[model samples]
Target: MNRVITVRELIEVGGFDETAVLAGETFLEKELLGVTSFDSPDGHKWLRPGEFVLTTGFPFLTHKESSESGLIKLIDDLVEVGTPGLAIKLGRYIESLPPKVITHALNRQMPILSFPMEKAWSDVIVPVVRYINDKQRMELVQTHAIYERFHRHLTSGDPVSNLIPLLHDVLQSPISIHVPTLKWNWETPPAMRKDETIVYVDKQIGQHAPRWMLNQPLARMTNGLFVRWLLHDQKVQGAILLRQPDRDLYAWEKVAIEQSAALLSLEMERQRTVSETYQRFRNDFLQLLVSGKYGSRHMLIRKAEEVGWELAEHYIAVVISVKPHSSPDVETWKENLTLLETIRRILSMCDLPILFGLDQHNRILLLMPATENDESAAKGILTDLMTTLALQWQHPVYLGIGRLHHSWEGIVQSYHEAQISFRSATHAIGLANAPLLHMKDFNELGLERILFADKPGAEAHALAEEYLGKIAQYDKEKNGQLLYTLQIFLQVNGNYVEAANLLFVHKNTIKYRLQLIRDLTGLHPENGQDQLMLRIAMTVHSFGYQA
Candidate 1:
């Protein structure tokens, strides 16, 4: 909304002629606050520098009152104050410009122009003001057009498919949208890529991109202005970023982008709510089936129908268990949720219907349709699933399978088999290379023997009494060195050199400790039975014998 006017424009419009004269000759085209007339004897003191000063040099320099020398001295003082130009009213003040003032003005290059006293200064100011006002109106119209296009797309109910195109059209630039997959890491996108298109919704936005699209020459140009929004309803499992090149977005464009992002985020949250509700229904249905609450075909069929299932097809069940090997504290419910989601995604890729349940025990049960394709493909699929889970989660996982059954009425049979396989895979003492089992291959009574042979509290109590007695004796004798030595020896498997290096002591010092252990406990670590007992005692002491 800024307007700069030139001196030539001002002169032509003001209708001034070239009769009035003085010496100095430069034109000052800067903005002026007000215009007024002044006399030379006032000595340019009332006026500041760099302003357009109007005068006729009349009253003070008239021939009867003042001499030419006094007038010339006044003009000299005015130039010293930085007056770059002067406009004079001629024929009313002096007959002509003083000779000395004219000479000095020419030498200083300060322009002096004359105007007929008949014209007013109003002729100069009005036109420039009107031009600036018109320019501002045009800028506002352009801003509103861009804002309207972005707002319309945001409210259209399909922001991912609609908003990017509207923005690209308005800005005249190509745009890309990416959504990330919850099952995989950020480097992979959940959905397929759509390029140079106007319509599409990605199932996974940021899963993967072409190498050319991500590397330099492209990413550097596009990613700098990318905007990201987290879909809060999805538990922060995914995000979306919008990218464009060539055009720099203005402040109004930034506002539009954020508003559209917020709308998309809300929609994603609504979808997640629906997904979670469906999952809860599936969990309740499976729990009822496994617990034998719905025993008859009629009862199971009615329940499945209520939950929106077709209810007449055969069902195959698979159970997956994630074991915590390092520490119980390391287990997380969110991680289990992610694992269930991944299994569901993989199963869906095969176009199968799967109902899954996850429990606090870190176990998942997937009840899928028992079509020929699924039954024939189950073994390879489950093996690949186990390997994928191990690689992705960086932990070992065990899976168990059950036989195919026809209809919801036979789900209990499959459930029993899956439970037995889960038990056998997890608890069988020395079984190696055991495939995921079917109901007939496993025996309920045999699993009972393996599962309940040792009560949890009995082993804990025995280890506690043995390890606690040694700790008490060591504490009373004021000899913590023996406990420290025993811990290090067991840690190194009785290697004298490694244990000594760990303790930063001579190798003989560790040998002396082993001798001292025999003196104290009357057990030699060189004996296999004694070594096993001591190792168990040390492990029990470290975890707290009380627990």
Candidate 2:
């Protein structure tokens, strides 16, 4: 709690006769000026005007050579050097301030004050200094307390449930800490309305929020305040918004909240990292199950249960299939994952806990607790989620949901069922036309083995050889020009000028070769579906098609 001593407080404490001297009404120790002990001018070069300088006017101003003109000139020089105000000792100086000096100070509004002849300058300055030092010390203590609370909550391994209570205790208010990152369909806060007293600390996010809770007068004026603090250390990690009662929060309180938020942000990141590691292991475990390595799945379930998930709970498997309109590379997939993580985080806000695992088949499986307690509401929530994701990513995704099962033993069965439904949804009439698919049809499970098959190495090799054989024949017949053009075009994703530059040919030459390839293979690179097939074919030819 930094004490802001007003000019009035200074006058009262210093025993200055207000009638004899005038002080600027706006002078503040923390804002307009800061007080520092001036023992020597040796190391205080950065001191400038607008800052009140403290001194006894002792050694230099005492000599006869330092006449009234010299004294006035010294004040003038200090002011000229950006010293907005000055504090002087009265007893050591000539009995009283000269009329000329007072008049000069009054005209410039440069505040000058005299301490009581008996009161030492050090005594007057000490209280203000002490106040500031004590404030800083208290802030340090509060910061430590915040970290302790945060560490306890995070290490206890329950974040969302513990966060509100921990923050409420620290802020001394009923805090609602809303993480937009964790709510998939959550709307962004809108611009603040008039008569709003909420403060926003915004982090850099690519998208804007569409709604603001502080926009309501009741929410805004109920002594309720909003604060946004950026998570400085993490890339793509969103901000923390603290909404507390509008009781005056001084510098120390603000510092404490900000520090606590920073700690929470770091802990959230750590938890995310641990979750990702667990998901990766889960993914590997599930893949082993699919590959008939049942022992690995059993081991992984044991390890996961140790980490807090109740393996015996009824769970449902959901498989998310993302078929890029055009074939996407690894970098594209990584960028998409950032957005997917945001969506997953949002879904976690619901009472149901979700665990995400990515399989070798490029499917995202979410293991959610199976209770039809609010199945309709959950579906509505999921529909909004799909819509939001489609709008955000500008691509379509298909979802397959499997029936609920009793335990971890049934996960593989549900997963296979979900995969079948995923394929059936992608192929059925009117179903394939829809942007989102809920696997309500259980009969789709019959095609599970055929839909998701693990091809032998020989069969995969044969397919690759057949595709490349055609491409090689086309290239040889055209003197290797077609293959060369295809390489450059695909590298640039069929951008003419870029491909031309890479091939050291005119854009027209590259375009002509692309047209020639289309004529030879009956595959138009301009069509997204054809382009995707060609891209996959090119990749398989270049790198053997084994996961």
Candidate 3:
């Protein structure tokens, strides 16, 4: 409704014709931009579209050779140029109207009215102009009112779902917002975006920031269209899907959708900012807790409580590291925000107090309440999370789980165990012909659970490092195969031929390397006690751990 005054309203306000005598009456609802008056014969030549012309019949009276026909041509010309209507002050220069002009104006739906000879342009022009300007002002007020309502809803922390009903009220059309990226909180789009819409949207998303039609029904929905991209600076956050079931949208409807998208963009940006801030806070807190920096359980509990975390006495830790598939459009190294929400949504049903964070290496660290009896429940939750993430996103994700621990400091212990288990699983999965010790194989991870687990007197067991440390230093200095030869030799239980087969070398070469290993250290290969010590050192070295 925020537009120029219509021709019908203009006539009523001006009282331009007492009997309402109109040559063309079909298009009274046509909008008029302004009013102009002229007495020249060629006045239509200088007229602008939407200008309602007022004239005394001088043009027709002066040109006597082509009076009726020329007037009819002028009437047709005005209609073609979108002049809504014309007002002729008759009875002075011309006696009565020409029938041809009236017939031509009527055909084109151009309203042509005749006023009295005594009336000046001022009598009608001022009143009509005042009415148009007043309507224009009123339209501005309505537009501001609409904008303010949307602004209040956006700033009031209402969810994006709440805006759908608001748009319904504004547009008077059934509308839905389809954002595939953030579907966790929103309803699924009326029609699932098929391969057609998906491919098109994917190709253009974050590229075009505008309202557009998909040119057809997206999927199940029929007869409604237009997708407005929700963008902040070139990045597409989501989209708004407008539905007008019976017909295409009007100009004002399009305007309302665009304005609503603006408010939606703000909501998306604010949420992004808040999510980032919260994730960062959680990240710092998790790091501090796992770093063992706090002096006591009381210190940790107080800090955890500050963030509304109810830290249970017994807790289990989980760590995940994900690497997204390579895409030319994305940065492969950055931690994906999608991973955060995916984890949140997947585990939301577990009925446990969950606290989680993301680490610098694109790792996720989560602590969940656990007890002796919750083993099956914990595994079920983990299995659900792992399966959902893998199936939904199809990324290379590694999950490391730790055994339940009873104390606050045990939380740090659980974290280290989980990280070590993760790295160990990764290393094992990479070995040629080795059975994979995957995170999902919790039942078979008995040895892995103790591989890097905390135990008393780690320094005492570190004595094995003295043996391998010399061999490691020699290999570093000479790039020799002595360290590897010693490890293989012990692994094969001092068998020259078996070690040679495993190393893909001649038995003589293996013997030769064993002699060199003997020269480097006094522990000869054939001695049982010395071989046992060397095997211990090899095992510790292979773990990539000194203690």
Clashes of each: 20, 15, 0
Give the TM-score of each candidate. Answer: 0.43, 0.44, 0.48
Reference-based TM-score, model 2: 0.44
TM-score: the better of candidates 1 and 3: 3
- Which candidate leads the pack in TM-score? 3
Candidate 1 backbone overlaps, count: 20
lDDT of 1 by residue, 366-423 (tens): 7756664356554455556555444434444555566666666557667656655665
Decoy 3 TM-score against native: 0.48
Candidate 3 structure quality by residue, lDDT tens digits, 1-547: 3347777888788875656656767578787888998878777788888899888767666444337876787787787777888887766666677777677778888887777677778888898888877766766676677778777886798876777778878776556575544452232334444435444554444333444333322223333455666655544545666655544444445556777776666666776688678778778788887777877778877878766677776667777665421223334335445566656644543444778877545577788667653656766766666665554444556567766666667777677667756655554452232222146332334334445444523522443564567777888889888888877787777898998999899999988877877786667777876676576566666666542
Give all candidate RMSDs, comma-separated.
Answer: 19.1, 16.5, 12.9
Query: Evaluated with lDDT, which candidate comes out highest?
Result: 3
Per-residue lDDT for 195-242 in model 2, tens only? 232123212232433345223211233445554433322333344344
What lDDT, from 0 to 1, does candidate 3 have? 0.65
